[model samples]
Target chain A: MPSPALRVLTDFKRWATPLPVWSGRLHAADWPLTARHIRTQGGRLLAFWGEDRRAEESAYLVHAAFLIATGIVRTEMVVDPATAVYPSLTSIFPNALRMERALYDLLGIRATGTHDTRPWLRHAAWPADRFPLRTDFPGTDLDVAADRGYAFPPTNSPDLHEIPVGPIHAGIIEPGHFRFQVLGEEILRLEERFGYAHKGVERLFRGLDGAAGARLAGRISGDSTVAYAWSYAQAVEQVAAARVPERAQWLRALCLERERLANHLGDLGAIGNDAGLAFALTQFQALKEEFLRENQRYFGHRYLMDRILPGGVAFDLAATDIAALHGAGRALETAIGHLQEILAEHGGLRDRVVQVGVVSPERAAYLGLMGVAGRASGQAWDLRVQFPPSPYDRLQVRMAVAMDGDVAARMAVRFQEISESLRLQEEILRKLPDGHPYHPLDLREAAGEGIGWVEGWRGEVFFWLRMAQGNIRHCRPQDPSWTLWPVLEEAVLRDIVADFPLINKSFNLSYSGHDL
Target chain B: MYRILREVLRLGKVGEKPPRTQRDPASASPSCFRHSLGIRHVDAGSCNGCELELNALNGPHYNLEQAGFRFTASPRHADVLTVSGPVTRHMAAALQDCHTAMPAPRRVIAIGDCACDGGVFQGSYAVVGKVAAVLPVDLQISGCPPDPDALLRGLLRISGEQVNS
Candidate 1:
């Protein structure tokens, strides 16, 4: 049987012509199909992006693509580069509502049919005339941003009053403003304003060499540092058609799983604490601390930042560290078991989380939800299981899915994932492949387009890289948080104002991850 | 009831952690002894690595609250303003406003490599550089995202305590 993507491509070729390009295949584009034909096929619009192709001509167009379960991605570009306005995909996909606005904010591309376009990420950071991502545009002029203002949508009904929270929260957190129109604790509408934490990372990528670019990817979202770095490394490797040593591939998997494990532990604790269960917080927090200390003692950095490089990992595991890791994994397993018992005993905690903040299974699939959140809501999609780059294909991942789609479901998924990661960790250490984990990546002269995808703790972290003359032309690290945040607006519908914090914590989407 | 009683019995003296008993660079501050600290953290534009480390301070191990330091929700009640990130253009005004909200004798500490000197993100178009660019910094903790030990040590400095960097 042809792969799922090959089957679609075969069918598309019969009806339409195909267009292809080179220069390391930096980005994906092809002959266009009408929006009607795209919707007819059973495809979900995974991500919508833009690439500045000024060198080809002062030309650029926004890209929108759909990814299906069969390891196949189909791309269809809308407007010609010369024409700035094009039809939007939101008519077909709800997720594109945010992506199209962001595409316009950064690149000055407008979507003709998009409904909500009241500035997604712009937040008046630049002048109306200037698109910062364009080639000819100069850097930010501070005066413009200072004088700029945002017209946040408001409600006028007598009973529906407005409430504004954050950009700066009460706790140790990132910033973003959420304005809600409420009628006596019932939220009529909730609008979110971001770009408060925009660091201009995509623009900064233009100034980096390949290796330097890899370092920045790790810092994209500290929690997913390993996943982002690995994604970038895989992209560089794909562009050059380089083969990583078997040892290095296994080592990378180890780090990715460890990153996943660490995040799950931390979130499990935080989610419990937010629900007003202090005991669960203490138990899980202690477990998380133990795990982090192990990571630091072995991996050097507690968060594993800058550990994964473009070629391979920066450090190698010694026999002693391997032994230490083995022991630590066993200890964690036992501790988690005890924690699970405590969780089971606390029935009141379950009531708080059980049916609270439910996302229907059909909506999750339609919205293209990802990672832990997706799995909890019965979206059977994972990059590692679907498109295993190397080690995971052989690792035999066990998929977990829950139809409940509640805060409890998400937490349960996290728990199951932690168990699975621990099992994978032990198996990897036992079947330790011998050789050097560090490989020298020499991409200084290499140029091409390559895509790297890995199943991060949150979901899938995707990186698209284009290189020329040994310098980065474009780098896009698509954090799963970008997909999760929009779905959160849907999830919080009608929930009481007090439950918002509990619900928000359950998803625990990253502001920095989405802001970038 | 049976499990709770057994656990209480099993749990021995949860006494002082040695690190807090020492007099450091922070104990030298006269106000350190007079007032308990309430820290309000702000993330201008960090990668969230620093925020993760900061969050860990309240975890079971370090437990900053045990040492008379608690994270407060209101800047009005805060005795110190802790900020991270290389002050993004959109956040510059908010940072200034947050700093101004704190009462006088407020200490401002810049944590993480980004906050100290803008680290990897220095000279970017969007950032206004480090905390020094937006607010006066009293103590700066260094590292890409300083580990819990480094942060705890630096935090101890508010009480007039000092330790090896």
Candidate 2:
């Protein structure tokens, strides 16, 4: 029973023959060694290639790695002035195809030995030659008319019928196109084409100063606002060596848990609603409203956006607020217990969800899934438990896990997580340290790269912030949606197209988060 | 009839319902709203604030379907075009085409601060500022991403339903 981090690190240390030393700065020389290090660390190879941005003199090769045991991630970049193409990781990791193609399309980075070079993320709307992420590229001129119709993969057989669900869905959900190839009721293949909501979030953060950058991060995905803000703050804070007060850390955890609880409650309710259980929807909606109202009463925003800043939290919780939070937590616990009882007794709801949209434990492990979706499938990789950056470490958070890998399993994980979050929130409120919520960090302009990992309601949210001369050079906000979206496709296999919504809702991966 | 009576008896005492008159009027519309919106949402390259708020609109607080605002599966069937994010280059055409596909008398609601006016990503290289830059927006709900309540109000306004406030 070694700690998850230690187990992962130890396995990785053995996997790679030549170990690489920790470099003070993420420079060009460290790329190869880092890649080797990641491979030895039981990490699934994702992609490796150079990106030539005309704005910078030196070109760089970006490498993505997904660690298996702990779901820890490492991305390496090396500055290579020479035009040397690296071999593709597709042979080693089949899933690297989509990511490699996306990198190629967005950054004009070429990957040698890569089998597929089809355009992804770059629709016909943008000039085929122009790469938007590069600074030197002129902005897209909207005045010109371009072909808007997308040619999806065509299925000729009568058995292979296509079901185009949305870019606009029946429910009030964000837009994304899901084209299902079904054989009668069972789905044979599911292809998702999104960017209907593509808002170049990464490129938007390129030039903003740290303070302004944090605000943009908070809005990355509204439900995960606290998680994104904290991750962005963690990156900046680490780069600046800024120390957040213990109380601020505790308060950050409280906010994160509240966000987690709020989302889980809503998700549980929505999952039920999707299953045609109106009673569950009404009950859960009422609970969720009360949950959000409590958030508004304490934090100015119901979603807790902008509550977290670079140095510390934007606002401090008063004693009265803490008392109110505790009271709310108790009430939530009672309500959740009652809801669980009802869910258990309702055989109709149980039958609909149980064994529906099953993602086997093996597949979940292979995909490197994270968050509640991964946990439900028995991959208990939680950043709070593994990384535990300060308050979580002190609080001793325990992750909730289930092995069924189905819609019901996902719901159970949500229920258990809500309960766990309530307990954690109470603990945080009870032992909150007394001090200023923020301590201004007199951060200087220096080039540094730091990784911020936070267990958002959607699993692990990873942020990579690179700063040069007091301004952000690059920011990568990786949501678990990147991993889970594919899993949703796999889970829907053998299920009818009509049941897709129920299955999809159970794994609620964020389209905007992925599009970013 | 006997089975129906037995089923009613099994459902223990129903909790006190909120006063019928005092209940939020916005929550009383037919539940079929999700079937009607024929919604086509476009992201004009936002900081993602509007998108989050858009997500909140679907969540528990103000379930949009309860009020007759549903998201459609395609632009051809949509009655309203909901655009969020500051209009960006990658999405400009899709945004326009989605609007064009919808039949006449369709309403366009810009749901977030970014969609209303680029909000934080106002002057970014990738952003085209506001949704108005590319399309005719009928309603604007302003908040970095408006709260779920504010989003609900904006949708209600578009549906020709009066807001209680």
Candidate 3:
């Protein structure tokens, strides 16, 4: 059965009507024309990638963008022999700005006629001529010298004071610098300099075969380990067209929801704590601890690391474990419901979150912002509802959206998602089918590229993997944080600097995710 | 406000006394001082796995403060410099600078395998191997991310606070 996306691509010319997703390959010259048409139809660029296949002059650049309203994911391929730079889509889709920059950093495929040509992902440490993602770019044992500093946008105003924070912060959070140009307490501009946590994650993917790559995928961002791991597995399986057992599919969904629960619980509490309310912190953290302990008891690891693999999951739910999880859900529902009421009535907390860090629906869509934050900002594009996998397709997922786009909206989205996840978890346990949970991948499946997308707790976690000769050829794990981090700089604009922490917590963008 | 008071009252003090890592630290290592372990954490290039476990340990359950484990903001005030990740290039200098900021007799602890010998990220171009590659690590707590309890145990042992049976 051809995918609906593929069907839409084939039928693009036949019908005058716009589909949710319209995708197909295009000639290098026709790229701009196709992109313009998509833009006119209100499509947004989700991800742009250049695949550096060193296999005898047959390399191509791939672009995947979403037309959200119709749930369309149009995929296009480009092959160039001369100046491999394609027409700049950033002129059409603003969100493609950083992704296009990263393309050049990785594969030397510059977006010709693009607005900004600044080095992204790769900093001064890497030499100008060296592109790390090239097939010949031996990623091992690179001796990098910190040769230069980043070219941050110049602050021309003399009245504005500059304050640089992080890469190493006051709290136990991850590293990523933020440069704020301000007047008194209000801000004029905020610039975020990430890639400080860049661990050569994409480069490391080449060192492992399919199974081991799953491990690296999970490690891409630990909080979204389940999402990344599942995405990676789905990509590998899609290429192989492997038949995953019904039971395993259900179990994978179960793990995904548990991950969603754990993160939402933690973030809700953290957001409250950041707003100067300590009571919410204790209650929520305690509840999260209970959730994690149950994860450890059933799944063998608290964070569910290495639990997901190539064709299926590593573990199956035991009879007693399912019963226990069901019981835990009931307890969690009551506890969360009680905590939710307290947070709703708390006036001080409400004031801090209400109008602070507002990202308009227009800006959110322009940035291609996703996950809970996107939903909070009135973007009703949840992959589970739009383009779901096997188990999720069967389950009814209510897409939550709020127009306010403030910290309050974000918190409200999390609350609603938590309850939804709990509901899904109980339903999954009630209807789990019996079969083998793990299927070993066939070696013959190592020749083509496949894309895996999952709506992780932080939003959408996407992975594009191409395997050849029993090893990964090119792997690019796109974290939703890359899109949302830029919005944080936008979100914190004009707000007093002190409220940065609260705003930051509401979005809770991942440095590792973007840096990777 | 009343809810806050009642919650705090119910969740009183942490139950256990600080586990004595050792009967005495002065005898084992004359150069070291052990009492309150002020830890300064530097995330060189981790997946945020170790940090989460650390957060969990500090929260109501493990109660890191009860065990005399505290996370300090400055290396100057810290006795142990706890570092995680593969020591990414951008962070290499910062890690060295943080180690430099600590006065003499300061302990360096590498948390997670990524910090130990680079773990899964050892050969990657962006990193400079491990924590020991850039700093003089006294103890290495191993695991993709070592369990928070294991990390606490490593600290007590390295700080000469672990009571050897």
Error of 3 at A42 (Å): 2.9
Each model: TM-score of chain B?
0.84, 0.73, 0.84
Candidate 1 Cα lDDT to native:
0.76
For every model shown, what is its TM-score relative to the native structure? 0.92, 0.84, 0.93
**DockQ for each numbered candidate:** 0.59, 0.28, 0.59
Model 3, span A1-516: residue lDDT tens: 223434444444221111133446666666766666667666666666767654755765656655545554555666574666777777777667788888788788887887678887876556767888777776544544442478788889898899988778877889888899999999879988777788878778874788789888989889989999998988787667677788888998999999999989989888988899878887777888878889889998889999999878899888999999999999899878777877888899999999999999988877767789999999888888887777988888888788899999999999999999999999999999888998788845477666777889998887877777768877788888877888888899989998999999999878888888
Better of 2 and 3 by lDDT: 3
lDDT by residue (tens digit), candidate 2, A1-516: 223433343333221101111222234444344444545565644223233433565665474645544444444455443653454555555556667677766677766777567776666545667776666768754332432466777898976788886554555566677889989888999988765555667778886788888888987777788999998998888778677888888889989999998888878888888888876766676677677778788888778888898888888888899888888889879878877877767788888899999988888877767788889999877777866777887788878899999999999999888989999998988989999889987665746766677889988787877788777877778777776777887899888877888999899888777776
Docking class of 3: medium
CA deviation > 4 Å runs, candidate 3 = A1-23, A58-62, A65-74, A77-81, A138-148, B2-20, B24-33, B163-165
Q: Which ten residues in a row have the lowest lDDT in candidate 1 chain B?
A: B7-16
* DockQ category of candidate 1: medium
